[model samples]
Target: MEKPPSYGDSNELEQPGDDRALPPATLYVAGRFVHSDDPQAPPLYELSHSVGFLSDNDRVVRLERLDYTVRQYQGTPQVSTRARHVYDLTHPTLATSPTFAYHAEATSRRSLCSFGMESFRARTLSSAKGYRVHRAARGPDHRLVGREELFTAVPARDEAVVFEWYDARGGLLARETDNGELLSLLVSAEMGPRERDALVAAWILRVWWEMARDKGLGRWDDGAECP
Candidate 1:
């Protein structure tokens, strides 16, 4: 397997590849779920249960059963679809088993009509490493994008855990940290809008998977709320 990105003095941040300035942007939790009012931060994305919202309170994504739909909040209505994902759970079959065998198509629109379809999958390797991620996007042919992994970081009494996604070449794409009280995300400034959307979609899928395992929810019919 390919190795993950290298971290440096800035905690788990990727070491700079060039001298170009990279602006500091941190989205701090400020609302019911994950929200940010900081001007420098990216759009305020909020999530709770099966629905999600942008800073403008526009419904951006909704999840149900095995599928989820994502709408572009700032695009033309004629083709505002941002992403569409359908999750499949396998392995041990029963929700009671903590085994992980799941996959989903987490695709993001490249334009108003075209999409960079990504195949996302997750499986458990051991108790120490909770889950492993593999995602690839297809243009004319399928190509490897990257994966998400956990790294050691400064721990806080209230902080839950930290997860980071890196591109195939070891560039940091995004990092998510959740505390019992709030959530935060540190995204790479170089990331494009479409790619960023797809990254967020991946997180949403992972979050739902985690919730299912935690609550022993065998089916979406259980309607488990976000915690």
Candidate 2:
């Protein structure tokens, strides 16, 4: 599999700084279902692209138009809007903090979930929990049933991100690692087809958002404007 781009170096892309703020750029991250060349593997959907929001000065402050591809029971392909999340950089978590609020909305009935994060840390945690699954509904009052915890975000000695997904009973479901750019996920047989698809979607969204957040923070730390 091809590795995604890294966000560490500002020289690769236009650097965003207070003195020389760049125009907003729309970068896209794609997620696709993977399988073997052999016919034995289940059919997968095509890659889906979603946009992450950047400020006028090119700082990521929100994520929008998140879409996921899913297959119907009749084997038809469908694209569904997952959720939109807005983040408050100054006080991303605390309600009383200046410009501190996190909000999310579901874009379609096909999306079985919606979420809100108190902060960036909480956003990471929620991503780790597979976006907090909920009953598919048209409104925001849906009840959350369960979630998937893939791994801890803490960096290892090698600076690699280790991941492990487990079921509610504590059975291991999947594992993978992210070393800078490349990220791989190994799904267990115990997971159902629906669950495997959901996990893959959540994993992709989380990774992309984190990268955008890192890039934005890098710019902000270098003295870019904030909300």
Candidate 3:
């Protein structure tokens, strides 16, 4: 398969820096982000227990077990045996630090993402952009795709641009904006299955992380961690 440069190799992306250097959390994108060939509307996917079209009542991918563990399913709304992830928490025997584990049958893939106390340093960035730091992977080897970053948020607005994800080359892979009701996702192109699934999983993590922060559920001396 054709490969993209990893985030480490990409020279264009700005490294995280002082919180003051970052833009305000309520910054907004001007217009629609969806492309001509996008899956649904201009803002492609709708946010819900299942990522699909709310307008048409279409259910594509179902996310099972939204608490600590998340399972991504493709077709019917059912449990997924392919991709399983443990986000922001771990089993009793595992480490306390927030991490991600992709489990498939007998084999184990390297974590698709991870979060730690240091991840919450940037107060302006969203949890997906700030806390979950890792790459999207494909296949049994879990080969990584360039870099992944989702940051910025538009706070306290009825309709606001939240965060966006980019490829290693600085191309927009996905952007999510939210209204009072639901989050609308916009994508640049027809992405691969793994890439699409990874984006959805990242969104779920973002939502949970914010819930933990808003409720003061899992907080540390420095910042918040999802419960």
Candidate 4:
């Protein structure tokens, strides 16, 4: 089977300080990384980072080596996923700080995106960039009931992106955004399935305007984890 894109390598990405300056900060990605002496490479844990805000905001997230960035806009009617360019950073997780931040390229891929740090919100409102889940009815015969929703008021990180699930049985399937606006759910169906997690930000965000139209859902299986 083909591999899927992931944020496992991203959460640990942070800015690196000067070589002649102070020691870099330490980072922990639940399991993938631990503090180490080597500035070139930090310790790797399991390699799976749960997105808190990205899945909730549906924004674009980019991880460039030791640098990680998320993008969002203001006053724009169109709500979109921010984008990131893949670059080789001299400083690795072993040599970077946890609170450090760097540059981000939002419209590099397209022309409509505006770059900025993303903030996760707790509730979804009538604002310009808000997400909501609708549940009508399954009609004649639809299995599994309804879909789920991950709502956010601010749509950033550290906030509550209310994840609500609604199935036919009214089980209220659990859905939520992790640390970044990352979305996820345990969906079981015989039709097309979601291959990657919400950590697959760009692919899922870039083409969502047309509802994926002729374009595929966008996958990282094409090449190295650059995209």
In model 4, the worst 10-residue window by lDDT is 190-199
RMSD in Å for model 3: 15.7
Give the per-residue lDDT digits (tens) of candidate 2, residues 29-69: 22233322233433233332322222223222322323344
Query: Global CA lDDT of candidate 4, please?
Result: 0.25
lDDT of 2: 0.33
Q: 1-227, model 3: which lDDT tens digit per residue?
A: 74432332233332231112211111111121111232232322222322121111221223322212245578535442322332222111124221333211111122234321113333455433343334433434553232344322223222355666555455655566655333445654455433443444455445444543355232121121111
Q: Flag the better candidate by lDDT, 3 or 4.
A: 3
What TM-score, to 2 decimals, does candidate 2 have? 0.38
Q: Tell me which of candidates 3 and 4 scores higher on TM-score.
A: 3
TM-score against truth, every candidate: 0.42, 0.38, 0.38, 0.19
lDDT, candidates in the order shown: 0.36, 0.33, 0.33, 0.25
lDDT of 1 by residue, 91-190 (tens): 2233433222333333222211111222233224524322344543232324234344321112222344476666545566656676543445576556
lDDT of 4 by residue, 127-187 (tens): 3232332221222442112233321122333245333323334443333333321222222
Candidate No. with top TM-score: 1
| TM-score comparison, 1 vs 2, better candidate | 1
